[model samples]
Target: MPALVYLLVLMVIPLGLVIAYAFLTSGRFGGVQGPATLDNITRLFQPLYLEVLASSVVNAGLATFIAFLIGFPAALAITRLSLSWQTVALIAVVMPFWTNFLIRTYAWILLLNREGILSDGLALIGLGPIEVLYTREAVILGLTYAYIPLMVLPIYASLQRLDSMLLEAACNLGAGPWRRFRTILLPLTMPGIITGCLFVFIPSLGNFVIPELLGGGNSQMIGNLIRDQFLKSRDWPFGSALSLLVLALLVIIVMLQASAARRSRKWGA
Candidate 1:
């Protein structure tokens, strides 16, 4: 009951305020002032904002794809290790959490900046210094790096729970590694993959710092747009509307993930 009350006070109440602000009129100065209206929500449909929303989705999708490509194998490898090594591997995966997120982002800036280690190393190798910082690629890299642990942990937990006998039996039946994984390992771990994708994709979609610092403030995702509206432009109503839209997107994604998990369980059963 205490926890519930705390959630209501911290999360629910704030969310209710944001929703109310979304409907209320913007003050001549900044915040809520006049009667409720749909104007703020309507403004989101304008071409400029629509494009920002689309790009945010695309960038997040690309980041999730990259994370999956890297994280799945890493998680699998960790599961294959000895118990102590497994602990170490997981610690490594989650070590970034020990650091401040902003500091980690700034570290990426030091690496990707023109005068940073990457460019200097490239120049030493006789390749010309390439444009990497302030690009979509940098933002994607940052997003992937920041969220890879989110991808790995869920999948690792799933893989760890898998029955070893299934693989051994498949091997005894003349199944190759690829066949065993494809037919047995992959099917069982579908829930984890779905969960990890949800974990990575939702946060990636709303990330602002990666785009702002790594993408040089040009690559504005939905979070960045919302921040600009509320603080920079002082368009509180519009910002509140965007926040609600993101919340709605999160709810929809969670529903889709839940559906996928149910289907996976049905198929596994």
Candidate 2:
């Protein structure tokens, strides 16, 4: 009853309002009315919205994949270290996240811009100075940098809890290093991989802050478009519809991830 009351007070009521609005045509004056029609849903399939959705998926997927690649190895390396070193490494991974998200993204702007530290440093090394900020590549890098620790946390936790004996046993049973990783470590750590992927993907897919600050108009993402519709354009109905699309996409991703976890569990067993 307590939990139910909290849900009613918080999530349920807010979601109900959103659902109610999504079905209506948003007035030009920024109001919603309900003689429910498929207008909003149909409009969602327009090429612009479709392109935004596709871009969100691609960018989020790239961030998730790259974070996993960096995290999995880092997680393993931390586990194989001395206790003091492991603690230090874990703290290092977490420290970046403890800073403000906006500040972190802004820091990336300084690092990746043509006149910024990184590009200029590369130029000093005789490499051509690259204009990187406000580009798609920079957006992806921003996302991957911001979220890598999220991927690392779950994976490192899982790796820490894993039995080292299984690895040794696999190696002794004539399994090569690659085979051991494939047969034992990867399967055991899949729950964390799934967890980390969901963590990075959901936020990246719906993110507005980093994209808006870093992407400029040329790299406009769905999140930025949604923000523009709601706040700048004051088209609540269209924004609500787009918001619903994001919610639906999140639900689908969660369901697919849950299904993947189940399959991995079965395969592991």
Candidate 3:
């Protein structure tokens, strides 16, 4: 009863309000003004908003790919370690969470900024400083750094459960390292990969902080755009619509992920 009441008060009510707000008109001064209309939803398909959505998808996709590339090997390395060492390795991968998220992002800014560590290192190597800050790549890099652990943990969980005898059997059959990984390891660990991708991709798509701090105004994503609608533009109706759109998207992605996980388990069985 308490749990149901909590859900009703916290989740249902707020979602109902947002849904109501999405249909209402925004006042000239701010807040809701008139009767509900579909204008806000219609405007979502406008070219400008569409572009932002597309770019957000692309940036998130790239971040997920990069995280996977970096994380899969890290997870494998952890799996190879002794049991005690495995715990340490896993802790190291998630150690960044011990610090504040904003602080960690600021650390990336210090490294990527002109006259910062990266630039200084380049100069020492006789290479000129590269402009990276306030760019799409910078945002992607920050996101990848922030979420790589999400990728690693899931894949590690999957890989850790794998039987060693399977690998030994594959080897005895003359399967090379690549063949063992491709035919055996890859298929078995796919659930973790999919879960990791969903974890990284969804958050990356909705994240404004990395883009705001690193992307600057030019590379604003959907989250930033929605923020602008509510704060800067004073367009509450549009903002609500955008929020609902994102909520709908998240629901769809979660469903798809759940379905994928079920399929993976079936394949594993």
Candidate 4:
């Protein structure tokens, strides 16, 4: 009961207010004032905003894919370690979280900027001054870096829970490594993969800071658009509408994850 009340006070009330604001008219003074309307919703479908949404999805998707490519192998490697070493490896994976996020982001800026370490290294190789910072690629790289640990942890948990005997059985039955993995391991880990993808993709889609600093505003995303609407443009209604769109997307992703998890459980049974 206490937790329910807390959720109502913190999450439900705030979400309700945002939803209400999305349908209302923005006042000249920067708050909702007039009668409710669909102007904000209609505005979101404009080509300019739609393009932002599409780009955000694509960038986030790319980041999720890349993180999966890196994280799956990393997690698998960690699982192959002894228990003591596995703990150490997991610590290393999450060590970055101990530092301030903004500081870590600034470190990337130092490495990716024109006069940064990357350029300095390139100069020695006769390929100096690569323009990496403030581009779409940089943004994707930042997103992948920021969220790879999230991908790793879930997959690690899934892998840890997986039965080694199953793989041994497959091996005894004459299945090769790739075949064992494809036919047994991969299917069993689908829940974790879905969860990790959700963790990476959702945050990437709504991330504004990485794109703002890394992409130098060249890769504007839905989060940035919503922020500008509320803070810069004082268009709270439109911002709320955009927020709702993101919220809806997150809900769908979560629902899909839940559905996949259920199917996975049934398969395991």
- Expressed as tens digits, the lDDT of each residue in 1-269 for candidate 2 is 99999999899998888878878877777778767877877889999899999998899899889999998999899998999999999999999878999998898888888899888898999894988888888888888888898899899888887889999999999999999999999989988889998889889988888787788676777899889888888777778788899999899878988998888778543
The count of residue-pair clashes in candidate 1 stands at 0
Question: Candidate 4 residues 27-139, lDDT tens each?
Answer: 89798987989999998889998999999999999999999999999999999999999999999999999998888888999999999999889988999879899999999
TM-score (C-alpha, index-matched) for candidate 2: 0.94
RMSD of each: 1.6, 1.8, 1.5, 1.2
lDDT of 3: 0.91
lDDT of 1 by residue, 1-269 (tens): 99999999999999999999999888877878878799999987899988998899999999998998899999999999999999999999999999999999999889988899999999999884877899999999999999999999999999988999989999999999999989999889989988888888899998998899999867889999999888888889999999988889889989988888888778653
After TM-score superposition, the amount by which residue 261's alpha carbon in candidate 2 deviates from its true location, in angstroms, is 3.2
Ranking by TM-score: 4, 3, 1, 2
What are the runs in model 3 whose C-alpha is more than 4 Å off? none
Per model, how many backbone clashes are there?
A: 0, 0, 0, 0
* Cα-based TM-score, every candidate: 0.94, 0.94, 0.95, 0.97
- Estimate candidate 2's RMSD in Å: 1.8
Worst 10 residues of 2 by lDDT: 260-269
lDDT of 4: 0.93
lDDT of model number 2: 0.87
Badly placed stretches (over 4 Å) of model 1 are: 267-269
Which candidate, 1 or 4, has the higher TM-score? Answer: 4
